[model samples]
Target: MSSASRRRPWDVHRLPSAEGSTFLVTGGNAGIGYFTAEQLAATGAHVVLGSRDRAKADTAMASIRSRVPDAHLSHLPLDLADLASLKSVADRLDLDHLDAVVHNAGVALDDPPRRETGDGHELMFGTNHLGHFALTQWLAPLLSAAPAGRVVTVGSFAARSERLDLDDLQSTLDYRPKRTYGRSKLAQMSFGFELDRRLRAINSTVLSVVAHPGGALDSLTPSRPPVSVTTAAERLRALPAALLVQGKDAGARPVVRAVLDPEVRGGQLWGPRVFGLRGTPRCEPVPAHMADAEVAARLWAASGELTGTDPDLGFR
Candidate 1:
């Protein structure tokens, strides 16, 4: 396929019949996650809201129930910053099977300051990448039980500018918060592709897909500069740029499409097509390095050691 004409997963307003399916959406209490959960519930699917804050999860569930009246929804606590909490939440899940998992929780820090999580890794890398890594691994069995399961990891356009700093995965040296965030996002995408390869190799039924919101405007937080504001000129440019950015609803399309579109290929990526930034949902290719077999193998091993969950799951 031509690079520019790659087939998209779905257009706006196209959704699958989710009647017997169950979904788990992290950070589902607000923003794009909330809308995605609401839409799924509207289609008669049972949704489990995964949020760090219990109160927020309650509020989200109440809002959705108020709208759908019969929306099947529940809440679970998940604090990505703490591995112990991740494990606890995983153990408490009642579902024996999961149709899809959307890893939507993320943090965008302002600067390159060194911040550590409960697990002792850089905050962004730990929460954005490692946390999801552990959660997905724990949920692998449930996902594998489904006839056509999907694991959707949310990534970002910033990943294009990131290079895997294996030498300093934790950003222990020359740490820049933005770069670290980009690297973490790259890790999320890389993990999705790597998981797809593992599933294919083992002939497993699970499918893995990665997606980014492009430049979606966040509703839960105030608008902020992208990453770097080296000068007043850059700040000036952000003013109009934010205005032109796509809405969170449009941004959530890729995630929704990735999970619902039957044509979505394992290891495929979905995002906006306009300027490769913000627009409707479409399928796109990730950088070749993101799917490199050798790098993926190394990353899988490293992640297993760091997160205490194996990607291969003994299915070599």
Candidate 2:
């Protein structure tokens, strides 16, 4: 069979049944995260919606139930920007064994000026990179206990903008919104790949994977319980871009694939098949810098230092 035919076709409707599984999705209250949770719950998995606002999470939960009446759903208050909140939520998580944890929450392009959270860390870097780092480490025990646990950290096409700088991870030296966002995503991808290497070195079953949603448009996506009430100005801004992008449900395909596709190996990155914007999920090559073992190790070490939490890789 040709390489094309050897590739398995991935679609939201055809996901492997998630019965008897449990998954946690950060920022699952809106956008692509919400769609991912809805899809997983539809397949009989119990989904824990992690969000900063309980009300928004409740709204997202109601939205999921409206579509999938039997959807098994729970909510956990998680604010990735705040380490205290992240640890509190992580401690509160009662799952015995988590099948997967989708790190899908972060600051988007429209967010305000670069600012530090209460922890004195940049908002995007703290939430997108350091926040997930600490949470994953705290949850490592639960994950290791699972038969085949997986952690899926979301990345972005913007990561191609600038190479990661260990000293300027927060972009304090020079902070451009676009570049800062890209740097955070680069850190996320690097840490994810490095995590896979460490897990493999220790012969652990937990797999670390990275995925990007490509481009998704809020104007084109249907708002169920209304995670955020889109203003007229925002919708107008999204109009032109909406034509070139996919809806939230379609954008979520890559993340779901990364979580459920049995063939997906650790250290592999998945994204849209068409120009990194919108299409079916497919394995994509990680950027040369992002794939570098040395860079990944540096970021991993930096993450541990910044988060003050060392990863528990089931080895001394």
Candidate 3:
């Protein structure tokens, strides 16, 4: 068969049944994360939304249930900024095995002199990068035995233009909010790629894949009552940009595809089909700089020490 014909068509609305599986989506209480959980839950998977606030999670879950009456969903109190609490959170998760974990949670300070986490690390890097690093290490046990399991790290298109400065990962010397945030995301994407290689070396069945939403605008997102409200004025104001960007609902496509598409492989980078900004999920080439093994290795080493989890021995 020809290459085009061999490719399986995907319908985001008509997901394959995953009745016996379970998924965890960090920051699943809102935005792209909420839509990710909602779509996965529609497939009959027991999806747990990892959020710092129980009330917000409830609102998001209720919105999801409003759309999917029989959806199996729950909440897990997760505070990525607090490194000490992650273990307890992992222990609290009552599941035999996890089919996938979407590292969709993140923090971005629009403008700041600089901020640090409770752990003394840069806020963005600590929460967005190291937090997920340690969480995955801790979640390894539940993922280890599941051959079809995946770890989907949600990266950012903004990270595409940024580079990592290994010496000042915490931005102690220099910290611009946007730059630091981009670097944090780059670090996370690098970690995802590194983890894929390490998992393969260890003969682990768990696969790692990275994805990014091109440009999802809040104004373009559909209103889901208390969960998300896109006012008419906001929609009208954002109308012109709709041609270039997409909604959080559409932005959720790539990660959802990464989680369930059998054809998607580890080390692959998926993004929007158009200009890496907005469209259906499409498998794309991994940019060379983004896939630099040496840089990822160094970041990996530093991450283990910083998080105090030492993923080398922590991840099963």
Name the lDDT of candidate 3: 0.92
How many residue pairs clash in each candidate at the backbone level?
A: 1, 0, 0
Itemize residue pairs with steric clashes in candidate 3: none
Q: What TM-score does prediction 3 earn?
A: 0.96
Tens digits of lDDT, candidate 1, 1-316: 7854785535467566788899999989877787778778877889998987888788788877877899999888888889877666646887778899999988879775689997888898889888988888778878888889999999988889888978788889878888888999998899899988888988888899998888875432222122111355544555666555765667778888888877788989999878667777888878887877787778777877888876564333
lDDT, residue 275, model 1: 67
Give each model's whole-structure lDDT.
0.80, 0.84, 0.92
> What TM-score quantifies how close candidate 1 is to the native fold?
0.86
- Over 254-287, each residue of candidate 3 has an lDDT whose tens digit, in order, gives 9999999988899999999999999999999888
lDDT value for model 1:
0.80
Residue 63 CA displacement from its true place in model 3, Å: 0.7
**Comparing candidate 1 with candidate 3, which one achieves the higher lDDT?**
3
- Deviating ranges (above 4 Å) for candidate 2: 1-9, 88-90, 109-112, 228-243, 311-316
> Would you estimate the TM-scores of all the predictions?
0.86, 0.90, 0.96
Report the lDDT of model 1 for residue 116: 93
RMSD per candidate (Å) reads 5.9, 3.1, 1.6
Off by over 4 Å in 1: 1-11, 219-244, 311-316
Ten consecutive residues with minimal summed lDDT in candidate 2? 307-316
